[model samples]
Target: MAMSVIRTKRGMVKPAKETPLTTLDLSVMDRLPVLRCNARTLHVFRHGPEATRVIREALSLALVPYYPLAGRLIESKPRCLQIECSGEGVWYVEASADCTLHSVNFFDDVQSIPYDDLLPDHIPENEHVDPLVQMQVTKFGCGGFVIGLMFCHSICDGLGAAQFLNAVGELARGLNKPTIEPAWHRDFFPPQEAEAEAQPNLKLLGPPPMPDYQLQHANIDMPMDQIKQLKSSFEQVTGQTCSAFEIVAAKFWSSRTRAIDLDPNTQLKLVFFANCRNLLNPPLPKGFYGNCFFPVTITASCEFLRDATIIEVVKVIQEAKGELPLEFGKYLKGECVSGGEDPFAPPLTYTTLFISEWGRLGFNHVDYRWGPPVHVVPIQGSSIIPVGIVGSLPLPNKGIRLMTWCVKEEHKLPFLDHMHGAMDQEPL
Candidate 1:
């Protein structure tokens, strides 16, 4: 497949002109205090003869109604209405003829580029406190192209963003407009009441970690068949079907614990996110925005880790999903605020691993005016060893592609070796 670049009119906004920072805008920021933490880069390419015409056609269709695809944040009214932006928030770039698209190469990193380089050099110091969602497009002499994107974590989670990009790709391919228009009705889903009921049994009860703990990524690249086989073997061994995430997480947690030689009797925990938008009595609408999500935690003692089977860990994780509720979201918000002052709250056990599954959703669809991306990868953030997984299965003849990045200091060979071993095993 040949990648094409398209040039379209830039999406409109306030043009950084009048009313730079309106009162309503400031208020909107106050509600969404959590800054964007996720950043990603994407690269696209083409091989064989240059297919400029085909690529151009793809780009033109990709840019129509470009306003919704690329734009900046604009002012919005107070708690009365949802926050809104004026233009599309997406951008694009074209590749030179010298580059060629290879049928074998595709990735999530091809779509994400750091926004810091695209921003103005000077901004109020306060503005720096909150991250800006930005992207850049670059063309390689070899006819390859790259698109980059930055997102504020407060606005959308990985699943939500993947949904947005998929919609953009659908638009490029002349699919129907996005299934759900973006919604920012923050008031509709405000923080939960402080006095909400608590599920004591479901609460996380693990040992506290040292202060100032940091997060790291464990990068492991393997074939897609291997991952699928790993999942299948895990299920066969444990007799419990698990998502790619659960499988990789269980392996990491197990291997890391064993590597550290932690006490065999100490309790261990696995904390993962659970979207709460639909869990409410009156489920949140497509646009009903706010942090309407909470973490689902699974706890097992060190003895369990040292002696339990992978299936047992997976079964415990499956059971933990049952405790998620709308109230948990509120509790989480309160805890975030409370922990801001107290250093004693469990430090998320520096050992906790955060796995984000993006490839399963076909995120390469964010074409804009350019053709499909070749690679996409997330940038580093705070204390979480974030592992982003992307790429198609059944090995596209080119094979499955996996991209991961973790702190170089944390030795991840054991976990990688385990993954390799699991992949080699036949599916149960």
Candidate 2:
């Protein structure tokens, strides 16, 4: 079915009231050239009466506290990025689709959604002069609407972004102010002076992009009951408790590896971020909204990963988790070697896979009067740095839902089989 989204209004949504004008420094992680792109997502609500007006007004008021989002990223110096905090405002668009929510099946298969039409376009001359955020609200013919947002990765991680959106929702639902004020204490994770000399243009810094991969998207559902049972099975055998993310992600990685069918000798890497908010010395403030996660990766040969038992892989993941403090210390000191690798500048290979776990990020709770969105998921695009990454989040039924780009098209069926088999396997 062909769908078209027509824009009815577009403009900058500035803070409801004037905000302070100041220059804000970004954390070292935020300055990474690899995080220059926007994090896009779609929030589908089936009953937003005045979707655009409510969100637009709420966003304007929310901006007063989260003023950096209303600002623009500027390279105060060469390769040095900071928010100008001039209150320029966020790019906002109001749109309408010709179809109904029922038509797209409430975006269950997000891979099929027309993201370009839903998300704000980004053709910036460069990363330095772009807004920290872009947003669009599209109303369907059936009163349902999708709020498409692009939050700069340089500004907020999964947790931070969710916090901000939840606050906006609070305001939209008639709250006079955010329950918690937003903070901009970025220098807490001081920037590295060396980064200023390393890359010319942020986008051009990485290795010539991997030839465009013809990947397939697989949406795997791990019902809570089955995921819990599998986790218990691992605990009974390995005597090590693993998180839902650990259990599910490990199974997913193994399934994907087997499906890719790469050379047995090929080195493979699994990359994911560990929230480092509490990992900081003083710990981030209650309302801090910033990039506070560090990439944690484990590497092995394809043969090893593919043949390893579920418990074996879970141990590997846990071992990687245990080293986060040590590796993070090295990252802070600029020792980004393979052991303490950075996802963006890693020695990427065809066998590398990136997993981003967002199940507990609380995105499903970002209510804007119409209750929570029926579906909230990333609007994945290939132009982004970890193009074919795997994203895990919670489905409406509270099951583990994985949106994967790591599966090769030709291996799709086997990949699903392997994935479901891995999850359904006995503990031992």
TM-score of each: 0.64, 0.90
Every model: Cα RMSD to truth: 7.6, 3.5
lDDT of 1 by residue, 306-408 (tens): 5655666666776777656533544544443222322112234444544445565445555544455544444555444434343433223334444444222
Q: Specify the highest-TM-score model's number.
A: 2
For model 2, how does the per-residue alpha-carbon lDDT over 1-428 read when each residue is reduced to its tens digit? 47999888877889999998998878777887778887889888878978899999999999999988888788878657888889889888899999998888887876677888988765456534457788999999899899898888888888899999999999999998999888888876545634533433323334655766566777888788997887888888878688888887788788878887888998888888888888878888989888878778788789987889888888999999898888776555555434422345655555667788776786878888888888787765662233233334433476777777665567789989998887876344
Q: In angstroms, give how far residue 393 of model 1 lies from its true place.
A: 6.6
Misplaced by over 4 Å in model 2 are 121-129, 190-209, 336-343, 383-396
TM-score of 2: 0.90
Model 1 misplaced stretches (Cα beyond 4 Å): 1-38, 43-132, 173-179, 190-218, 221-240, 286-291, 326-349, 360-362, 367-372, 382-410, 422-428
lDDT (0 to 1) per candidate: 0.45, 0.78
Provide the lowest-lDDT 10-residue window in model 2. Answer: 383-392
Residue 185, candidate 1: C-alpha displacement in angstroms? 3.5
